[model samples]
Target: MRPDLCLENAGRRYGLRGPWVLRGVDLTVAPGRLVRVEGANGTGKSTLLRLLAGIDAPSEGRITGRPRTAYVPERFPPALPFTAVGYLTHLGTVHGLSRTAAARAAGEWLERLGAAAYADTPMARLSKGSSQKVAVAQALLAEPELLVLDEAWTGLDTDARAELERAVAERTAAGGSVVFVDHDPRRLAGLPDTTYAVRDGSLVPCDVAGPLPSGPHVTVEAQGPPDGRLPDDVRRTAASAEETGPGRYRLTVPAPHSDLLLRALLTSRPPWHVVRVAPRPDAPGSSR
Candidate 1:
């Protein structure tokens, strides 16, 4: 089981006397949770993400239980010497995959992000959108337990943005934690498990009952493994999981997470069998 990442009274500053960019931030990012950070420009949102990603150490307080982490910075360095595939493959191996496996995963992510044609292209020569795709791919190829994204969707086109969202869902479904900051208000609007806004150099929990209506939901019926045990990821992602019969369970999840939930079931070591899936009748925008 993955451990929860905790920040206790965390604070950061440039120097001993520098003003604090963030202070007294207490947060716990547990497995299978999606966390969103919101703030206006120069509000230190990026600084907080950097602290969470371990790119910067807090000047005061402490952060513990950081899992295998990957980060996508707001501005990707485009002048790297290696080709797209080369850089990703190297990073993959650093993340502990074997050479062959790393290369394979690198290729798979590039294709999924619609940057396959630029596989061998020099990182410096690629366009901003393509480079951003590479940035997203590198972080995902390793399947990190903790993913930190700072405006990772900024330069991508429409399809890639949607793909990234699915990837986020998949990560959480697989028992990983994702913390991200996006400029668009509607980005994953109804999906985040917790949302925090950076205000006055502090982390403040946002009221989830804001303006956006709860979106549609899906009901899934599935059979557990031979021992009638469900994977932790499946159990965590489902809004509700009920045992209807021996080894049989019904899971209700937001519509966006349903596909990843099914994928997690089908891809587990002792794969689960999905019996049926249907939209919830009472869900918003659902047809009677």
Candidate 2:
């Protein structure tokens, strides 16, 4: 049986006479897998993602298994007239949700990504980071079967970026496929099920079993009132927290998850103040 998405010797180029940007690519995207694409600038990464998201057609060869997909491009046009929430609602409907359902999902995603307060703000008025949040929310409003992220984390706050990481994890956990390209080499650390490098206009398999760190862990210290609380999502990671002083507390989280924890502390309704984020005492190179 064919995988959820397959490209057999697929290739693409611009107008008839344009030089080929991507060629002779064979890829199979299975269900519930995390695929990462890596390459330098102007090397066809965006072209490959666009083709996978069905935004562009391949000039040659065949692609099968068109799953319902959502794509977040590297750049988001923020001049649209719709309010952030309204825009997301519109996209949700386009993705097949009912009007009421779409609106609710929009609110939910906006809240999750820390953009709820700007829900009513016009897209043109939102700051770059806020606009990026809206762009991400729109793609996630309908729970697409395939999620393609092209540097989608750019311009997002630390917390929002971590929220996106969680969303990616959720999508794959629910039996969906995810493909992404991020500038950070440690973006997801050692999690992708497969990694492919775009080389010479073709796709090449990368070593998924590379010796990357398991999960760089960090310790954070923050200060807040006695009654302050952390975000609910922080519990997902094996994080530990405790009050160390009259108004100071400490949290130990996996490095990748630290952003979420810190965001929770700093963005809380009362807003805890972070003191420091350092590698755990026992972590590699920490003692030296």
Candidate 3:
């Protein structure tokens, strides 16, 4: 079957023959699966997402996928409380959803995100986490066949984080696809079917250690006291270990790396206990 999302030798640049942010990326995100793209800051992670969302075209290769796709950016767009549901309705309409369907879809997801109480609130009064949830809800309102999220959890709290996982799980289980671009894969444990490390326009496998299919070993721990921990949104971050062990709960994430996700989740209060983080067998670029 044709993949839901395909990047055929995709390439992009910032200037005129000066530097290409992305070189040649070959990848496929199929239905009922997610292919995460990881990389460092300014590495075109967001750029690649843009190309895939149909917002922009790759300078070189072709990005093929379902006709409609959704993108959740790293820097979330602000939505006041009062404008929240209305905004969702607006986006749904743009996607060709009817007023009633848009209202229903908006209400359902808003409730799922725990923002239903503020359905009529203005965007200006919503908290950062709340607004981020709105942004997430907006991107996902259409329930497009393909969803591309770039750090969609950027400003969400722990509860909101869980909500995201639940949404993705439910979405994909119904034969949908997700293309998530986050720094660390550990944040969304029990998720992600395939991961990719984006380095200079190249898409390669991420060598997650332990039982992680492939990718770097990352660890996420509370920097300070575990009991008095902040939320993941406030101090989000994670880490990885070099060793691999049996009977350990190992998970795999794509390219951006665990450290980045850890830092972002510092406030989210990631697991500080070593027992939570299993060991990995390989670093980046490893086959086994």
Candidate 4:
């Protein structure tokens, strides 16, 4: 069967005489899969995403099997003259929804992203994080067959970031395709079906250590008094743990149950002081 999207020897560059940002790249996105793209600065990651999202045309090669796609750029323009909900509603209509439906979805998304209070606020008046919520909401309003996110999580708060993760999972579960780029090595952790790294102007395959433990996960590192001990329950269900320093330890816990684990540690007779809670990184992957 044909893939949902395909890039055959795709290449892109700027001005007639400019150097190629990307060239001779080939890739495919099948239905229901999540793909992650990684690269260092100036490796054409954003350019590639723009090409896939149909925001920019490739200067050479060919792209085929274009699906209805939505993209969230790394930087969103929040100065548009419209209220938060109004802007999203307009974008939804542009994506083909009825006005009423668009308005409804706009409100729904804003609520989901914890931005409902700003629904009536003018876009220009929203804060960076609030604007990012609108950016994410606009892309998801249409339920496009292909979703492309370029550092879409940059300004989202913890809950909003987690909500976006759930949205990605929902899209793939409904048989759509998603591709994203984020600086966090653990962004979405071990969930992607395939990963590609942009290097030296070409796309190269990369290996992820493995799928994340069968549920949402987080790696929590903590430091406590020399005599404090983690609750036995925490150690029992934790995927792994290790002593990082004299009184520091890192523990991996299921995200849904993280609060319980955290509470256990903090409520212990001699509580363990939490240091950091971050998404767990997939095992080291080979990158060319």
Identify the candidate with maximal lDDT. Answer: 1
Q: What C-alpha lDDT do the candidate models reach, one value each? A: 0.87, 0.83, 0.65, 0.84
Estimate the overall C-alpha local distance difference test score of candidate 4.
0.84
Candidate 2 structure quality by residue, lDDT tens digits, 208-282: 664333465788888877765544433333245566887676666656556656766776667778889888634
Ranking by lDDT: 1, 4, 2, 3
Per-residue lDDT tens digits of candidate 4, residues 1-288?
235698999999899999999999999998878899999999999999999999999999889999889999999999999999999999999999999999999999999999999999999999999999999999999898999999999999999998887777667655688999999987776657789999999999898765344545678888877755655545533446677787688887657446656776777667788899997545322110
lDDT of 3 by residue, 1-288 (tens): 335678899888866676887878787777767567788887778888887787777788887764467778777757434488898898889988999999899999888788898788788778888888888998788877778888988778767776786566545644677778766556554345676777766778875444433443543322334233333222211222222333222223333334334433332334333334344545433222
TM-score of 1: 0.84
Better of 1 and 3 by TM-score: 1
Give lDDT tens digits, candidate 1, residues 89-134: 9989999999999999999999989999999999999999999999
Return whichever of 2 and 3 wins on lDDT. Answer: 2
Q: Give the per-residue Cα lDDT of candidate 3 at 221.
A: 28
Model 2 residue 186 CA deviation (Å) reads: 0.5
lDDT of 2: 0.83
The 10 consecutive residues of candidate 3 with the worst lDDT sum are 233-242
Q: Name the lDDT value of residue 117 in candidate 4.
A: 100
Which prediction has more favorable TM-score, 2 or 4? 2
Q: Which portions of model 4 miss their true places by more than 4 Å? A: 1-3, 211-288
Error of 1 at 15 (Å): 2.5
lDDT of 3 at 118: 79
